[model samples]
Target: MSQFGKSSAKRSKPSYLYAIIGVSLILFLFGIVGWLFLNLKKSGEMFRENIQVHAYIQRSATKKQIDSLQKYIEAIPYVKNLEYITKEKATAKWNAENDTTWKKFLDNSPLPESMDFYVKSDYMNKDSIASLQSELEANFGGRVMSEFQYPTETVGYVSSYTKYIAAGILLFAIILSIIVIISIDNTIRLAMYSNRFLIKTMQMVGATRSFIARPLNVRAVINGLIASGIAILAVFCFILLVEKFVPWLKLLRDGRNMAIIITGIIIAGVTISYASTHRSVLKYLKMKLDDLY
Candidate 1:
C-alpha cells in the first residue's frame, strides 16, 4: 500500500512539472509575439509621418497656375492629401516660427507659394516618393515650379532601414515560433510516454484510441488555456508598467487596435497549444512500447 502511495505521488509530480514547463514556454512565446507586434506598429506609424514631398512654386506663378498644379497633384493615386500655402501665408508661418530671424528675412523678399504633398501612408518610401517627385518635375517643369524639397538624407535612410529591421524581426518571430512549438510538443510527448504502460493496459482491454487520448487531450487544452491567460495578463501588466515609466510608448493608443492585437495574441496562443498538443498525442498513440525505449 505504501509503495502504491509512493508510485501515485510520483505520477502526480510529472503532471505538475509538465504544467509548469508548459506555462513557462507559453509565456515566452507570447512575449516574443507581443514585442514584434508593437515594434512593427510603431515603426509603421513613424514611417507615414516622416514622408513628405514639398513642391515650391515659382515666385512669379499666377493664382491659376497654382490652382491647376494643386488639382493635378491631388488626382494622383499615391497622394493622400495636399496643402497649398500662399506666399504671404508661408512668410507669416516662417516669421512666427523664427521670431529672432524674422526681421532679417522680411527685408529680402516674399516667400514663394508652396504645395506640401503628403503621400499615402503605405506609399511613403524612397522609391515611391522619388518617383512621384520626378514625375511632378517632368510634368510641371521649372517654369511654373521653382524646386522640389524633400529631406532625402535623414527620412529616406531611416524609413528604409526600419523597413528592413521590421522584416527581419517578423522572420525571426516565425522561426522562433516553429522551434518553440516543436520543443513543447517533444516535452509533452516525453511526459505522456511515462504513462505508456497504463495506456497499453487500457488499449489491451479494448479501449479505443480516442478514449485513451481523451484525458490527455482535455488536460492539454486546459493547460494551454491557463498558460495563455496568464501570459496575456503578464503582457498587459508589462504594457502598464511601460506606460507608467515611458508614457511615450503608446503603440496601441487607439482602443480598437488594442482590442484587435489582444484578440490576435489570444488566438495565436490557443492555436499553437492546440496544434502542438494534438500532434504530440497522435505521435504517442502510433508508437509501440518496444520503440518507446
Candidate 2:
C-alpha cells in the first residue's frame, strides 16, 4: 500500500519532451508567417511608391518655367520622389521598356520633357492622384501640358487583390492562434497527469494548495523558456535558409519586427505553459482520489 500510495515518477519524462517539440514546431510556423506578412507589407509599399506619375511639359516651355515646375512639385507634401526627365531621357526609357526608339517611328522625339514623380503610399489612391494632377495643372498653368498619367486600372487591381490576401491572412492568423492555445493546453495537462498522484499524496500529507502549485508552476516556466528558445533557433535557421534562396527577402528584414515576433513567442510560451500547468494541478488537487484514476 505504501509503494502504491507513493508517487513513482520516471527519472526522465518523455511527455514533456513531446509537448515541447510539438509546441516548438507550432511556434516556428507562427513566426515564419508573421515574418512573411511583415515583408509583404513593406514590399507592397515599395511597389506603390515606385508607381511614377508622369507630368508632361509643354515643348515650348522655358528653362525657368521647367525649373519652377520641378521645384513646386518637389515641395508638395504627398510627393515621395520627383525627377525631371528630359525628352532625351524619356525617349531612352521608352526605348528600353518597349524595345524600340521613339525617334525611329516619328519625326524628332515627340516625347516631351516631363516631371516624373511618385507619391507617398498613403496618397496612392484614385482621388489623391486626381487631386494631385488637378493641383499641378492649376498651379503650373500651361507649363503642365497635360493631366498626370498613371496606370489607374493596374493600380486598382493590385490594391484590391492585396486587400483580399490580407483578409485571408488575418483569418488564418486568428484560427492558428486558437489552435496554438488549445494545443498548449492539452500538452500541459497531459504532462501534469504524470504528477497527479503526487499532488494528491501531498494533499493527504497536509500540504497547502499553494505549496503543491508552486514547484509545478516554476517547472512550467523553465520548460516554456527552453521550448521557446528552441523554437527561436529553428525559426532563425529557417530565415537564414530563405535568405539564401530568395536573397531579396533579406533586404526587407526589419530588426524591430523580428524582435517583436520573437519576444511575442517567448511571452506566449511562458504564459500559456505556466497557466495551463497551474490550472491542471489545481484541478487534480480538487478531485476525489477515486476520480483521479
Candidate 3:
C-alpha cells in the first residue's frame, strides 16, 4: 500500500507541474497576441488620420464659380462629403478662434470663402488626392483656386516609419517565441529526464515508439489546450481593463474582426503548445541514457 501511495503521489506531482507550465504558456501567448492586436489598432487609426485631404478654394472665386467647382469635384469617385464655407462664415470662424484680434480687424479685412472637400476616409491619400486636386485646379483655373493642401510628406514619413517599426516588432516577436518554446521544451525535457530509466525500461520491453509517444502526446495536447484557455482569459481581462481605463481604445469595434483576432489567439496558443511539447519529447526519445544522466 505504501508503494501504491508513492506511485500515485508521483503521478499527481507531474499533473500539477503540467498544469503550472500550461498556465504560464497561456499567459505568455496572451501577452504576445494582445500586444500585436493593440499595435494593429493604433496603425488603423493612424492611417485614417493621415489620409485627410484639405482643399482651399481661391478667394477671388464667386459663389457661382465655387458652386460649379463643388459639383465637379463631387462627381469624382470616393468623394464622401463636402462643405461650402462662405467668406462671411470663414470670417466668423476666424473671429471665434482669435476673438480679440479678429474682432478688431473684422471691419477692414475679409476671410476667403472656401469649399472643404472631405473624401471617403480611405480614399484620402497622396496619389489619388493629388490627381483629384490637379483636376480641380485645371478645370477651375484662376476663377476658384487658392491652395490644394494635403500633407503628403507627413503621411509618407509616418507610413515609412510605421513600416519599419512593424518589421522590427515582427522580428522581435518571432525571436521571443523561439526563446519561449526552447525554454519550455527544456523544462519538460528535464522532467522527462528524471524518468529516463523508466522510459528506457519500457523501450527494452518492446514498447513501440508510437505507443511510448502516445501518453506524452496526450499530456502535451491537454496541457496546451488548458494553457491556451487560460491565456485567452487573461487577454479578455486585459482588454476589459484597457476599455475601462481608456474609453477611446475602440480598435476592435467590428465584432467580426474581434472574433477573428480571438480565434487567432486560441490557435496560436494551441500550436505553440503542441510544437513545444512535440520537439521536447522527440529530443528525449533520441537521447542516450548517458546523456540523460
Q: Please name the candidate that would achieve the greatest lDDT relative to the true structure.
A: 2
- Tell me the TM-score of model 3: 0.71
Candidate with the greatest TM-score versus the true structure: 2
Count of clashes in candidate 3 = 0
Please give the lDDT score at residue 14 for candidate 1: 71
- Models ranked on lDDT: 2, 1, 3
Model 1 lDDT at residue 45: 66
What is the TM-score of each predicted model, taking all chains together?
Answer: 0.78, 0.86, 0.71
Clashing pairs in 3: none
Q: 1 or 2, which is superior by TM-score?
A: 2
After superposition, candidate 2 runs with Cα above 4 Å error:
1-12, 98-108
lDDT of 1 by residue, 6-105 (tens): 6644784676477546655666565647564765676576667656778999877777888888998989977766899876678778867866465665
Which tens-of-lDDT digit does each residue in 1-293 have in candidate 3? 44543664476467547654654564456465656555575566556553545567776677788788888777877775567777677777776777656555457546666667566545544666767877877887667878776677865665556568668767776886666556655555555554555555556677777787777667766666666666667766777787789776665455665566567655655565566555655666687867766
* Clash count for each candidate, listed in order shown: 0, 0, 0
Query: Model 1 misses residue 71 by how many Å?
Result: 2.7
